[model samples]
Target: MKRIIPFILALLLLAACGAEPVEAEASPPPPMPTASPLPDYIPPMDFEPVSVWQAEHFSGRALLYLGAEEDGVTPFKVYSCFMYEVTDYLDGNMLMGARAFCAEAADSGDFSVDCSNRGLWLEPVLGASALTGKLSVDGDRLTLEYTGCELAAWAEDTPGFEYRLSGGQPVIDSGTGENDSVQYLPTEFKRLPDEYLGRAMYWMPMFEEEASASAESVRGLRVGDTYADIVARFPNPLDIWSRDPRSVSAPDGWYDTFYGSEAGTVFAALFYEGGVPSTVLITCCSYASFQLDGGLNITQLSVSAR
Candidate 1:
């Protein structure tokens, strides 16, 4: 009976020591969300070729420039600029208007950096405090988006303070596209009355009377008059240039001179009415010129000093 009992105990121990296969449970991977494509309504850049009128409401040729990241990067940044030529508005007070300046992040960079880097050059025309907002490039349209900025420095004497002078809207040129060569349009036409035409050319000069000797003014003299005559009667000019009616070009050597110097230069000339000299207008430096209503007047003029 004892031997049988020992044998039974050994059998039970062997059965208890036998091994069995165990199963393992795996962990599930984290989920990944799909990304959506960019919207179709937005353009690649803001600056597209277009026509813009002058402060005087005369038609002028306009072109825009936009700088964006060519390299592929997220949350891209951009810079924008504008160039316009007014040929025949305001009796040619301004031959052209050019604006090349940039606005950085509202939260990034020193505020005066813009002034030193770009605004100082454009301030005379655009005002020093005018640098406000991010320039957006939406394909062919150039949009100037204001960053909720309101400072006394940007305020102008004009009615409503014309924020377009300071901020707002896209200056679009419908004529230019991806394949088209850029060009400007004239602000004025050939047929116009003398008094109105004289006003067109002489208005800015007339308004400038209150300015001190440091400020520049225009003198209406005959075409045949010598340079001495120009200097003797009018205030001393910082610089002078002559305009050719045939080509609508100034001695500043056409558009090339304007681009090269980047300095503010003036073009002066005598216009004839009924075969008689009528008025003398100064061609204020700008980027483009266009024919709009009467004779060639400057629709856009650059006030910045290089």
Candidate 2:
């Protein structure tokens, strides 16, 4: 009886020691935060300014002279003075050019003359026909004074109206008992496209060359080509200004389109008929007008170079 009692006590102690421990439950990790979505991105508009050119148009009687002496001076019926700042694209050259329209019969009742062909010239300085002038700048204003400037009616009619500038002002001797002076001021100025001005003034010859090349390349685009095909052929244009369908004119329809750079150094106009190109006009330092047939084939090509 005593041996059986001792064995039972030892078995109970072994069972308690072998039992597993009870552990407290652990809390799950805090849930991760939801990420916020980002806003959509929009592209900015492209704009690049190349240079500054300003002109002032004046009517009525105005005297234009180069230097002090008024030799070879002819009275102008109409006058237009211009100032060009080519420092941005050119080698910091400031030039002045003027156009004076002289009427053959001042009393013939007509004061109109075509001044479109008249070209700009570098205002002479001190009896010299220099290509550029000295520029002076004030607040919102620029003054270009020429020493020995030359004035003329046009390229064809010229002995060269030569005179010396006294105070950057022209002495308007009306010869009617009135002596008044007029100064050039650029109050109303318009910023012209850099490309156009560069080609027109011969400031950037390479721009002209590139424009010519682009025009020639685009000419290969046949009249039957789609707008997509045209874009594929000529990828980068300055911009596509127009893309309106000809709904009213023809049921087949057409589109009048213009493509060029911001400066307008070179540009092309494509007229699409029946959703196909019919005509293409390219202008770069000159103009090339192309007419196409119904098959988008080149039928007529007229090119003019300046």
Candidate 3:
């Protein structure tokens, strides 16, 4: 329905809770604060980072920032459309939002970066997306001048997107979902010399797409995982917060809840129907909800329980 927060900002909000060690090393739940800013805790990335960047000073304008070189990481701050979210990033649709994972350089010293992986819980939302625009750095200035988005294939098996079905067909809203404003066009960045990963922002900044298949789980818990597994993994009560289920996105017997239980988390919710996890709701991926011709459920993926 109405948006409480931006798609995945919830993960940014829960940047701490989801990272707690499982049962054995689990500690007692701390006093639940009413509010908290983002935290500083960088875990080892499962994938190699091409150009790791976190926005040092968000201009709140169109300007981008680049971080200085340190501990094998660099913050290549790129501009995402401020008005709207990126579409189907994990479903193979990328935009300027895709984190730079590929690097290429020519004899003239111009460089380009291909971003594949994002930070935080979204680290798994990666694939070859069409909107993988490179930051062409000609000498000192860097610019993302690519403007392209893939047509929504409306495929049945998108792990990182969701579509609502009406009469077995998607209710297509007619119009271009693109932002024609100049602010959304190609942008430039001013390089900065600082390490703000753990200081300025809580985690690595990243954005995603609209194809569907639930890609988020608490403590790496996945679909088909047992309730015992959830309990064992998150022994702390506050680790996952059970919430009231809504008929719009819920299934039978399953009550609704979220992976992160802090103030700003609504991105990823878990559905338990008295057994193993039956469904997972990733509200953070897509922008406008698309109507699908065939039926689509709230991202029931078969991710490994192992």
Candidate 4:
């Protein structure tokens, strides 16, 4: 009975040693968080190109008018014009021996024509004439059509070419006399600077004699006036500030100071050389910076909103 018991115990121990061990379960990774979307962004409005005119000029050729629409609630039109006299025509549609004939505003009647050395070239007489045509642009070409007598006369004039007159008006024939076409290539045209456009808008109302007269007077501050003189002119001045010439590496003798009105609206800058007031710059909302140099002499003026 004791031998039987020992054999049975040995059999039970062998069975327990042959059994496999158990393992722990692995945990799932935490769920990733969702990302949020961003807000929409809007851009500013773009400046629109209005009209462009191209014509033959004395120096070569010139873009007579380039117009652009100002960016604002109120619509303001601004344009620039350059006039030229064509001396000769070369191959590849190039004008030879051309000169700067004039500079003018296409919309406004104000213009400056260079009449110096008028007797030199008298054959193809090109004068300062207002731009006349229905200006349009297609793809990259700028087209200007000279229709009727008014446009034809301004387009070109030869030494002895006769105009086919009808009913006391010049007769314009299609693809022939009177009617003319001017096309400007991309290389020939250019965009006027924004400063000039701003200047044009500012001076739009200066056509009146009263406005011009008022502009001439710089709040009773004339050129050649000393700093003390200017101070005396404005009893209750708003603010006064100075800029050190040495800080700017300027060799000028004294510091430059700017004075303004009490309301912080009107401002004027005085420049000094050798301790004498050499220049004065007056600024107003309506006009550009009016400057007087040579002891307060009004030498430089720029009227611009920007």
The whole-model lDDT of each prediction reads 0.29, 0.34, 0.32, 0.31
For candidate 1, the per-residue lDDT at 247 reads 33
Residue 73, candidate 3: Cα error in Å is 15
* lDDT by residue for model 1 (1-306), tens: 989999999999888789565567655322222212212111123333122211212233222222233333113222121233332333322233333333333323212214332232233223334334444333433343443322235333322332232222323222212111111221112222323321222222211111211222223323333333332332223333233233343343233231211222333344444433233333333211221112323222222212
Q: Which stretches of candidate 4 lie over 4 Å from their true place?
A: 1-132, 139-141, 151-188, 192-196, 199-293, 299-306
lDDT of 1: 0.29
Query: Candidate 3 on 2-66: residue-level lDDT in tens?
Result: 46566467777688677877567745333222212323322233332233232222212232444
What TM-score would each prediction reach against the true structure?
0.26, 0.27, 0.30, 0.23
Q: Please provide, for model 2 over 1-306, each residue's C-alpha lDDT reduced to its tens digit, 9 standing for 90 to 100.
A: 999999999999999899898787866433322222222211111212233434334221122111111243212222233333333344534333322332221222222223233223211111222212333334433333333333333322433333334543432211212111112322223334544422222221111222334434333433333333333333233445223222224433454434432133244556666665566665544566667554334566555544
The regions of model 1 sitting more than 4 angstroms off are: 1-59, 68-98, 104-113, 116-125, 128-130, 137-142, 148-306
Query: What CA RMSD would candidate 1 show?
Result: 31.2
Clashes of 2: 14
Clashes of each: 33, 14, 25, 13
- Ranking under TM-score, best-scoring first? 3, 2, 1, 4
Of candidate 4, the 10-residue stretch with the lowest lDDT total is 202-211
Question: In candidate 2, what residue range of length 10 has the lowest lDDT sum?
Answer: 173-182
What are the candidates' C-alpha RMSDs?
Answer: 31.2, 24.7, 21.6, 27.5
Give the higher-TM-score candidate: 2 or 4. Answer: 2
State which candidate has the highest TM-score. 3
